[model samples]
Target chain A: MNHHAAQSRAAYLFLTPFLALFVVFLIYPLVQSLWLAFQQTHGPSITRYVGLDNFKSIAVDRLFWKAFWNTAVFALASVCIQLPIALGLAMLLNRPDVRGRAFFRLIFFSPALVGLVFVAVLFGLIFEKRTGLLNVTLHAVAGFDPEFPWLQQYVMPALIIAALWLYAGFNMVFFLAALQNVSRDLLEAATVDGAGPLRRFLHVTLPAIRPVGSFLVLLSLIGSFQLFELPYILLGGGGPDNQGLTVVMYLYQAGFDAGDLGYASAIGWTIAILLGGFAVAQRYVSALDER
Target chain B: MTPTLSITPRRTLAKLSAACLTYAMLAASAAIVLTPFAYLLASSLKTGEDFFGSLFLPAGEGVFGVAWGRITSANYTRLISEFDFTNNIVNSVFLASTTSILATLGAAMGGYALAMIRFPGRRFVTNLVLFALIIPAALMLAPSYQLLYFLGLLDTYTGLILPAAAPAFGVFLFRQAFLSSLPPQLLEAGRIDGCGELRLFVSIGLPLVRPMIGAFVLITYLGTWNNFIWPQIVLQSPEKLPLSVAIAQLRGVYSQDYGLLMAGTVISIAPVLVLFLLLQREFIAGLTAGAVKG
Candidate 1:
């Protein structure tokens, strides 16, 4: 008992430095943000007990809803399009006969190395109406003159394209790792049973990698919800029409831009609740798939 | 049942067509993937006058018309001389390295304790980390700023480094690694040898967690290097801002100068790009290791 007590003390000692920092930074902020959501603040220094006024105001805020919806679209694209492309590429590259596997894998994943901000910055010009490569290519190949403001006009799709370019490779890397773990014997057995490649993939391979797939879905959902830099830069911080304002952007604008720290806290709480809902939905869906 | 000799004309033709289709798909996807990077490189070299002169063709004639343009390094020179590239790069490097080192160190110890030691409320601590994982960081944004301000840490590297040191992912990773790789007998043996707790940890625990430490370091470094929003929110001073924020601000500074902007992006991301390439395999493995385990 004494040994156990001493050991536990030592363990607690080991945990102190990290937990000290974690509680202050991670834990305290969470609790404080929840509390701050219910209050009102003029700036960093000004505070008043508002008693749910911030939340009340947020419920009627049009920009909040717009940011929510825009973020939801990004999340949807990540799951529906980005993940599938990644899975397809992984499946393709996982084939036994594919040549130059290393080269292709590296090429695909190179984009992920570039920061999201850099992607937003680089693609801002790459999609420029006049000097942009996208338009230039379209003009040469199809004899179609490009005139639309790719960033300002079609904000969501353009952002989605950039996201796909950057993240498909990232997801592909993960899926590829997951695919390699699928037992070849099981696949061969299914093949001998006259299961075509598609059916085998659907039944055997997919079932085997479902955990990682669900994990990736969750990961991408979280990633998309954290969408700030891409939209912030690409659309020049919420765009002319405010079509690109993400939830985090709204929080940022509220906190820094408007100096409404309390309202920003409220926005932060809403985002937390929404993300929690996503986690629950992801869990429920994964459970259903498991059954 | 002679399957080996079953390669009839139709079968051969089918296989060939399938291979061709596979190659075509790969090629198309590769093109889409490579286009932006190709454009980034080619345009980085172009003169302002001929920035949009030709799509694939560089500004002047010969060698894709980009030969002389590549020689100038005008954008790069301007980025360093005018845009505070060197300072920003140094700041980013310092911040990222500090955050990465601190986060990894804390995670390793915390992971070691969680994985090895019998302790009170270990489960609670573990659950707290799991909760941290689920909680959206956006929830903490306003409070973090306020907290940092009260602590007088805003706009400082300590502000960035301290908060990031306790990432749930790193904790989980180190714990998992320790659980898998650490042998309890070493601790038992060391304790019998009368080594103190701190010494035991320093001598045995440190070596056992090397793989995870390396992986966590890479991950945290990458994350810190790429981080934008929190730094954007916290660090307002140009000199203190990391590359992520500095480059983001570069857009306002050099609005129409695409070459300068691209140069900044390339320079800011260059170290991370090299590190990512070198450690890409381990990085991918570290990422998937958790999911694959799940």
Candidate 2:
């Protein structure tokens, strides 16, 4: 009885800091945000219970819908472009016969290590209309006009490119590590049985790395939804005509700019639900595949 | 030994084609990845005239000769003196280091307890941590900002470091590392030697999980250093801002000074690059280890 009592005390002691911090920072904020979602605040202190009105406002708001669509487009485009390229790079770097693999891996992964703000700044320069390097290069190489605004016509694509550059290498490292864990004997046996490289990859490699792929896909999806800095910096926080405004950026603007804390809270809850639903769906899909 | 193996022409062609394709793809990918960085470097080196005139090409006048002329450390000097870049660097370094150490220590204790000691509510605690991980950070923004305001920690380093130090990801990563990498006999031996739980963690558990600790330190430090939005909201004073926020301020104030902007960026990115280069192997190992466990 003493031992059990001592153990429980120790457990609580061990958990105190994390639980305290979580309550103060995470859980309190979480509950408060939900509360704020329902209660309308005129200023910082003026609060009134408005029930579902804030959520209703969010549902009908055109800017909210635009931001939602923008976010969805950004997320989908980023995942579709990044995953296959990262997988292919991982496969190439995973090959035993490849020389200078470490150097290639390092170069590839270098961009990801750089802060997102730096990446945003770099791409911002590159995508500049008149004096930017990208425009200059296009003019020199293909005689393309330098006056064209890359961000205006190609906002999503430009963001997707930046996303791919920053993330593909990082994701490649994960895939490479997962690929390394595939049993060498199985691959060797497949090769010995006259299976081609592509055949071996399809039949053996794909199965072994499927879990990693699923995890990356899910992570990328979540990351895509939370996308903020790159678009914020590159396009000047929602760019021309709010074309670049992602959901998180919109949420930030609403909370900070519009001071619509209640409405922003609704958006936050909506994002959480969407992300959670997708993650659960992905897990289900993975389980079904296993079965 | 008697039979000479001969490759078929079709097989040879297929192999050659595959090799060529791989090379082409890698080259293209590398080009795309490196172009923006290359542009930044080139632009930084070009004269103002060359910057506007031949922006795509390398300047005939070197970085020193262009604009400020003769390799002036002017931009960097200005970055430090005018922007208080030095202070921002110190603030970032201090915040990152403190967060890393506090977070690692907290996680180490939590992870060791969860992994080695059997206690009631273990499953519940683990599930809660996982739930924390899945919850979007944006959800916590408004409330956390308000809480920080209430505590009178707004614009202070404590505001930046404390909220970040309590990240669920660190605990999750450490727990996963402990489960897989830590051996049971060591803990038993420590207990047998009459070592207390805390001592066992400090002496035995810590050394065993050095790699994970290293990994957590890097991830935590980098994440804190690069954080933009939270700091943007919390930090009101320009001097208190980290490099990420400072760089954004540069954008707002000196939007036209591409050279200076790129210089600031290059300066901002240098430490991370150096750290990455030094710890490339450990970084990869840490990432792979985390992914596998997740």
Candidate 3:
């Protein structure tokens, strides 16, 4: 055999274990999920082939719609509000004038060390209406009464706040790492050309980190959709009035809680499609932003 | 720039205030980040009564007096004794450690094939890995559950560990690292010296790729350690559930005691937190491998 052919054989031999596992666990499951989406499942087995019924049902399903809306809102907040704050703080830390950069970086990155489950549980206590730390502090410091409905009337805001606290640090670290690579000479050139700090930031620094910036946007978008466990644990059965009920929560309900595996598979496919579109749009926008 | 920096009173004042503002912002952000954890510690230490009656757990019976008094480990003891948290912690450690080690090793092998060893269909295989990475785990939940069920792996560590044991992210990162960094001359030298493929991979390639292994292990361990929903679905027996699922059950009206709940939360995250603190740089690099140069 030629060297290239022999090498290919050796490569295949080396790849056997990974390929086997990946095929059995990841690829096969994904294909099976797609197939499952097309059939009506009673418990675990398929009862009938549902051509377009599952997709059609989701279009009219109010709870499903609500979950989608909630997921969208949370995602927007993550992309728009939380990520910007993280980026701005990262910029501040990246500034040479700042003292104790390592110290500040460690402090900012601390929250991310704790897992999401812990954050959810901690926030359950923190956002509690009565005898909660937030309310007590507000009442003491600002003389505001602790009557705000967090878990009930304002579940989205509450969930968003908790999530922001948990994940803002992770994104901040990402931005910080990106910013560390940004060529200082570019910023200096912008400055020498008479751009002020904000102007230099807008023109030079922003463009320099655009790749990481858009990457963060994409990360936030995908992370926002995978929202579960936190809200599920915090709110307990989708919170009051199902306001905190997220897309994954709805998927979980469909498959396990309600035992409608077919509908659950449909929801999963819908999310994959939605995420693909957002990712494409985000890529386009970022490409345009680069110019 | 220096000509513009004439130290006028206004310019000096502006610069000073900007510095102050920057420090103020950093401090505020740190406070916001730290409060949850501080409360976690405080709540974990408080007696169940104190936890219920007080907002800040260590407050010495009055708001202003807020000095530490009567902090206890009773909650931790109770969590271990009552809910079998020890078993779950062991389960979590096992699941996270096994998956991380296996995933890293598997990715190393696959990445070596794709990057070091020349192969046909390599492009197609790499594309498949990217596709796998893009498909979120939530979307795979139902089918994965059914697959595990059919394989008779449900309620077993194999179910939890096997799915994530050959993760696509690991494969991608290891491939990129090896392809970009590994010297082909070294591989050729090893081959010329009559090292067989397996021996060459172990003696030469694996050692040179320590950082990639570190990255993969950190990322995979962090992910699997914090896994909740997937493990919850598969793990039916309460004793077999990882701390993620066990701690989650401690939420809501089921939360008979805040101290116990917080204690469970503490135990759930303690190992990962310690790991993160020690491997902070590696953790960040592992997470941001594709995005950043480091």
* Top model number, DockQ: 1
Instruction: Provide the DockQ value for model 3.
Output: 0.55
Which parts of model 3 have CA positions greater than 4 angstroms off? A1-6, A278-291, B1-17, B61-69
Which residue pairs overlap in candidate 3's backbone?
A: none
lDDT of 1 by residue, A1-291 (tens): 776787898888878878999999988888888888887887777889999889888889999999999999989989999999999999888887789877799889889878889999998988899668887778778976687678768889898989999999989988888899999989888877778878999999999888778878888988899899898887778987888889999999998888878899999878777667546744643343233
Superposed model 1: Cα runs more than 4 Å off: A278-291, B2-13, B56-59, B64-71, B193-196
Candidate 3 lDDT, B1-294, residue by residue in tens: 364457889888988999999999889888878887888888888885667666655566555677455678998888878777789889888888888888888888898888888677988897787666667767888888888978999888888888787777777777777776789998899878877778878888888778778867888888888878888898898878888887887675566477778888888777887887788776677677667662
RMSD of each candidate? 2.7, 3.4, 3.0
Query: Could you arrange the candidates by DockQ from highest to lowest?
Result: 1, 3, 2
What lDDT tens digits, residue by residue, belong to model 3 across residues A3-82? Answer: 56767888898788799989999889889888888877777654578888999998889998899999999999999888
Docking class of 2: medium
Looking at model 3 chain B, report the run of 10 residues with the lowest lDDT sum.
Answer: B54-63
Instruction: TM-score each candidate.
Output: 0.94, 0.92, 0.93
- TM-score chain B for all models: 0.90, 0.88, 0.90
Clashing pairs in 1: none
* Cα lDDT of model 2 by residue, B139-248, tens digit: 87777776787789988988887777676777777777777777888877866787777677778878888888888888888888888998898889876888999898
